[model samples]
Target chain A: MGDQLIFTYIVDGDDFTRAGEASSSVKNKLKMLGVDSDVIRKVAIAMYEGEINMVIHADGGTITVSVSDDDITMVLSDSGPGIPDIEKAMQEGYSTAKEEVRSLGFGAGMGLPNMKRFTDEMNIDTVIGQGTTITMKVYL
Target chain B: MTIGEIQRVLDAQFLYGEELSDLDADFVFSADMMSDVLAYGEKCSILMTGLCNSQVVRTAEMLDIVCIIFVRGKMPDANMLSLAMSKGIAILATKHFMFTACGILYEHGLRGGA
Candidate 1:
């Protein structure tokens, strides 16, 4: 409200069930702050997809969300196996998730695209054998 | 149609949020993949899925889907039920398969919107 409201979360990669916890919390907070429903929906969906990716691919990570007057920004960082090809990964049906993840109703290769679709700005930074960090923003 | 009517049409048993059954909805979206639901599921009031997990409830929460219908009589675990309860999203379990459940709701005038 004043400067920028910052919320951070540690995504547990081992527990798939708890993946969306941070996104849900942020969504509720945004609602309490009287953010527009459409904006809240965008943030929630993008953040939730990032959360799922963290669990399914990255094996855990950190998510930092900052809400400002102009827009809401989400930064998700993970130290997992970095993506090999950002272009291929961005494809709507390109996925490297395992079969087990598919059983959970995800790994449909729509995570990154969906994230990009719902957010106004999205950037993915990855280094092989290092990690990956995704930054997404949805204008308020 | 209201959630109560859908329940009656499908002979669904409420796993949670039966009090919210009186809530009305006209659009239905059925999917086993949460990604598909998130991608094209806007304005959909009810989500019908055979996938029973906490993410299903979370997906519904993100989409503002008021109710989830689990086909093939699949039941949600305690964690999912608790999550849905806190989110005020209703849960229903029906014995019909995905196609059957969707058809029944479609026949009852619940159309899937574009």
Candidate 2:
């Protein structure tokens, strides 16, 4: 990693309507920075999914994004209930999201898989009762 | 086909981005589920959905989609419209349901994104 430019955002759990604000902000910043479209696309998609997950599954969380010469690193930390089975959660179409969430056009169990698909690296740290933190990186 | 052509074929109304009406797109993706859109929608320039929300515009932004058509007479509120406009995504609304709108476009030779 080269010199890093870090951006932090708070994902509000109370409002489902504002979930993607952070991702949108990051996308605009990356665009202004003249990053490649493909890299920006990947980061935007991965981070947006993480933001939605925070609002839907967790109460809310904080995200830290670091922009470097070689890659962009995103760390999403939430204080909501943690995943009991990371393995199961990784499976596509295996979602624990409620019916209401599905109606909102999410909770299709594609969030995690899509995040992994768009990022070069991903790691999840979770404790059942404590919370979850997901780290994802997209290489430039 | 051009977005303007699609608008004419469907008799749709432009809620925003009339300036972008002439833009052309090779592919179209229609769905109410944003998750499906994220997973299966690729290389689509126009997104047609009945699900109206801020996330819909956000999803289009992430995918680099240039246009959005709200189907089944669904009209996005002011907030959604403003967000879409700011992101430079043209917004269109049609009375035709999701299936009908997509079918009309397909009949006119617009292909699915797949």
Candidate 3:
């Protein structure tokens, strides 16, 4: 593989049906690159959860995944209403999603915690009324 | 057990991947929330859920779940079916509710993953 390979995807918030497209694409790409299955699974799940969060709360976002020999890094950025309380949002069962989202089998307040649980490292940067950016990494 | 046996056990109808009936999975996870599935579903090869949507299939694909059993007679739309087909993930539908379907699978030796 190259020293570093990067891929970016634009997530459309209006379409709930298409939320995990980017993560799926990345997973296939990593598979073709011969990345470890466990690593690929971790990246896919973390990014998929981030993708769902972007759709449900951020209204839309851009996800950039970079693959290298040592680790894989994913950055999810959004320009919607930012997370007001990172601490609360990080809780396992604290959620601000509506009933509609719950009806779709999501919004159980597990997105951020699951993201953190799956990845080796996760960082969140947010500003109230502005936007949020989440960066995650998984070591190979 | 093989997916075929699981189908017979739960009286499920295959919506896709009927050819994969020979596939075997020892562990099964049941949940409606995709996040919970993502969090703890890695060790399980079969996912049983009441949620019917494209994201469910997408979640299965990410987790490499061999099959998804939609309980309570919930049906997945064409787009979801095609997506699951393309990913080589089997889809099953049963009239049994989540509790009963899971119980049947458990009784048949499909244990939950740690």
Candidate 4:
């Protein structure tokens, strides 16, 4: 809580190529702050996947990362169409990304699975018509 | 194997990070999909792909991948190269196909991610 760094980002939906900028920025800041390399990597990978999901699926979102002594906590909230089936989406090699997204070297059906792989904990909150929120944490 | 050796085996052009050509790497994974790379690649490795974009470089940065070799003679745009320089990740280019590039590196002792 006290003296912990709380970084927030608003991911822009329009620019597909710019999707990972926020995650990259956070990675650099964490490096400067001297977080452990392994912890930094896990956090970066999870954040990157979530950011890409925001761009490709959510149409945009806000991510808040709170860095403290014990763990790195991330909360990602998006306003796009919510996932109809969380279980299906959680399956590896399952994706709904369009062909164009696949052409861009993504939409590989690996995003959610990879996020789950890197984080110590994950939670999904969604509404059919509204949006979804994902909370993840990686213990440092 | 050093990145320079991987470049030589693939007949690659060191588009950036010539200073790091001597940096060592032990393996590679060829995929345009950053997700796959993130899920598969390991430390002291290189990523070979035809995808030309800033995210590729950013992904390499996040993974701490020492080198990225763009195959099929593709060149990343200015933004990507700039980001690569900022991140200190080596960038290379070659006319070899992804399969061929991975093979060459494997021929030179670099294997796929375990």
Clashing pairs in 4: none
Each model's TM-score for chain A is 0.98, 0.97, 0.98, 0.97
Q: Please say which candidate is ahead in lDDT: 3 or 4.
A: 3
TM-score of chain A, predicted model 1, versus the true chain A, to 2 decimals: 0.98
TM-score on alpha carbons, each prediction: 0.98, 0.97, 0.98, 0.96
Candidate 4: C-alpha lDDT:
0.88
Writing each residue's lDDT as its tens digit, candidate 4 over B1-114 gives 888777777888988998997887777878888888888885636888899888898788889888999999999888888889988999999999888777777777777875
Considering DockQ, which of the candidate structures 1 and 2 is the better prediction for this target? 1
Residue pairs with colliding backbones in model 3 are none
lDDT of model 4 at position B62: 81
lDDT of 3 by residue, A1-140 (tens): 76899999999999999999999999999999999999999999999999999999999899999998889999999998999899999999899999999999889999999999999999999998889999999999
Give one digit per residue, the lDDT tens place, for model 1 in A20-45. 99999999999999999999999999
Candidate of highest DockQ: 1
lDDT of 2 by residue, B29-110 (tens): 8998898888878688999999988889999999999999999899899999999888999999999988889889999999
Determine which window of 10 residues in candidate 1 chain B has minimal summed lDDT: B105-114
Error of 4 at B67 (Å): 0.6
lDDT of 2: 0.93
Residue B44 in model 2: lDDT? 89
Weakest ten-residue segment in model 4 chain B by summed lDDT: B39-48
